[model samples]
Target: MDATTLNSQAERFLAELHRSPQTVRAYRADLRHLTDWLRETGHGLEREALEAYFTVHPHWASATRSRKQTTLERFCRWALQHHLLDRDPTLHLEHPRLPPPHPRGLRREDIERIFAVIPPEQTRDALLFRLVFETGLRIGEALGVHVEDLDLTRGDEHLTVLGKGSRKRTVLLDDPRLVSALRRYLRTLGYTHGPLFQATKNGRGGPLRYQSVQERWQGYAGRADMACTLHQLRHSHATELVNGGVSLATIRKRLGHQHIQTTLRYAEVSDSTADAELRRWRRQRH
Candidate 1:
């Protein structure tokens, strides 16, 4: 088919894909680039032509090529369904292999040093960081916390977190220091109802946006010379818990993970610790 016809078909196919707006825009851009190449080379939308186009385009990185291939594959599927094409061009496209996993975590001293750098006036931000690190909460979950979710009067010393997929779970904050920090922050804001951490203008209260929290974290990290992201705080929390002899099942429930496998990724339990636990269990049984 001609370039104009192909463009029209691609647009319709993307509309039918029902992907998120950002994803749709990206796919559309990739397809447009492919279409331009096809027109310039006077090549038809055939499998051999598509392969040649990729082979000739040395500028595309492996990851970019993979994403483009995925886009074209989806488009080809739609085209085949609509009889726009006889066969899929991207059926045998190879995806780039991802690199090895590198776990990012902060040592206890690093955490302490970062917190110490926070000025007293920015206690709210510091406490927010502490809450995420101590509770293993996603940034969204921490930002979504409401005043009612924190039962400070409860003797159990835990906070109710509304986590991913709107799942509720109780995450313990066993450290009295963290609890006190939270209480002090709440008192300073004079926030007794609704959201616990609200936006403020010269100490006047409003709703806090997640992006604002993220920017604050970036600024704090920059100032402290700490090579860490906010999400790493969650990792630190999980690592600390795993090292402290907390069971995987307990951590799973506390972290509000739907799957145990998801929780297992966070458990950085040392081999020595695992062996010791196994020996302890065996001795008890004997």
Candidate 2:
């Protein structure tokens, strides 16, 4: 088949893959790389050309190689099914191996220090950070929050969050202090309905752009001398829950993660607990 035909086939296959938009974009990017490499080598959309390209390429790191391989594999699978190729060229391609390591989580004191650095004049910024840290919300999810999402009534104390893939989940706001703070902020803005955290002075709430939020966070991090992103606040909340003895499954559900493995990364065992476990193992060996 021609190169244009092959590229078209790849796009159709990707559409059929039912992957997320982000995944589809990455696959398209990877395929473009392959096409570019082929053009440089004066090779067409044949199996021999693909093999020649891989033979000269240096070994890539685990993550990078895996992503490239995945893109090719998907393309090959689609090609084979459609009779474009008799066999898959990427079937024998090797992906780099990686070692498992625990995810980095912030200490409770570090979290406090982050909060302490927020300037008093930037009440909105402070509340944004606190809400994300306390709720374990993804930046997009937090930005998507509406004023009606927060319920501050005596018995009902929780926020309804719309997470990735349009999934809705209710996360508890058990801290009365946080609730009070949120209420006070809301009162100041006079936001009774519509988007909760909006970009406005008259309180006619409109969507708060993510870039503005990120820029504000960077400034806060700079002043505090802390290495933090909006995501770190989410990590802080998840780590706190895991260390406080909350179940992995519960955390996963609360965080609206489709897989349990995503939640497992957030688990942070205390150093003392790790030491005790090591001693117990040593005693057993003895």
Candidate 3:
């Protein structure tokens, strides 16, 4: 079949799946790129054709190429299952080796400066930002927190969060300063129940939307002149724990990482830890 026809099939396939809009868009783009290459080379969507295309167009970054390869493989598998193709072309396709970059986290100085610059009037923003940094919680996980999820009573203090894949995990609320901030913010909101972070409208309460928090975060970033993301707070927290000699298993559990490899990325980012290891290695060599 022609590239355009196959491309349309791919689009229809993706539209029927329960994928996020962003994911659908990316998959569609990947499909389009593959079809375009096939058309240019006068080839069918076959294994040999794909291998040739990758060989000829070897300019993509490893990560980008890997993503595209995954997208194409999924598409090919679907096509084969649907009888659009006689066989799956991606069954034996090898993805390019990905060189994982060091995880980027905010410097201690940057974190301090940013927190210090948070205006007193923006207590909610301050609390949200600090909460994520203190507990390696993703922005979505932080925003998803309900009042009932918190256990700030005298003896125990932790928040239960629904992490990726709807898995639940308990994260400690260990910082007294953060606990104080949360208490004050909750008091100001007069919210004795429901979402810990709430939206106010006409003196009524509702769940605070992610978009509103993102807009507020943009303003905070601009004021602090820090080009960082809310997600980076999670990375910063994880890196801090790793550098402080926290065990990988403990860090993985705290960060809700399914794999220790994900938590190990923080260790990769800790230059001080790397330096210490290098010193140990040199002493051993001597």
TM-score of each: 0.63, 0.62, 0.64
On residues 82-160, what C-alpha lDDT tens digit does candidate 3 reach at each position?
8888888877778788877676898878876777778888787789889999998988999899888888875568889
Cα lDDT for residue 88, candidate 2: 81
Worst ten in a row by lDDT for model 1: 94-103
What are the Cα lDDT values of the candidates? 0.83, 0.80, 0.83
lDDT of 1 by residue, 173-269 (tens): 7878889998887777554678777787786778788888888888887788988888889888888889889888998887788999887778887
Off by over 4 Å in 3: 1-102, 277-286
Expressed as tens digits, the lDDT of each residue in 10-39 for candidate 2 is 778877988899999899888888877776
Residue 50 accuracy (lDDT) in model 1:
83
Candidate 2: segments with Cα more than 4 A from true spot = 1-103, 201-205, 275-286
Candidate 1 CA-lDDT value: 0.83
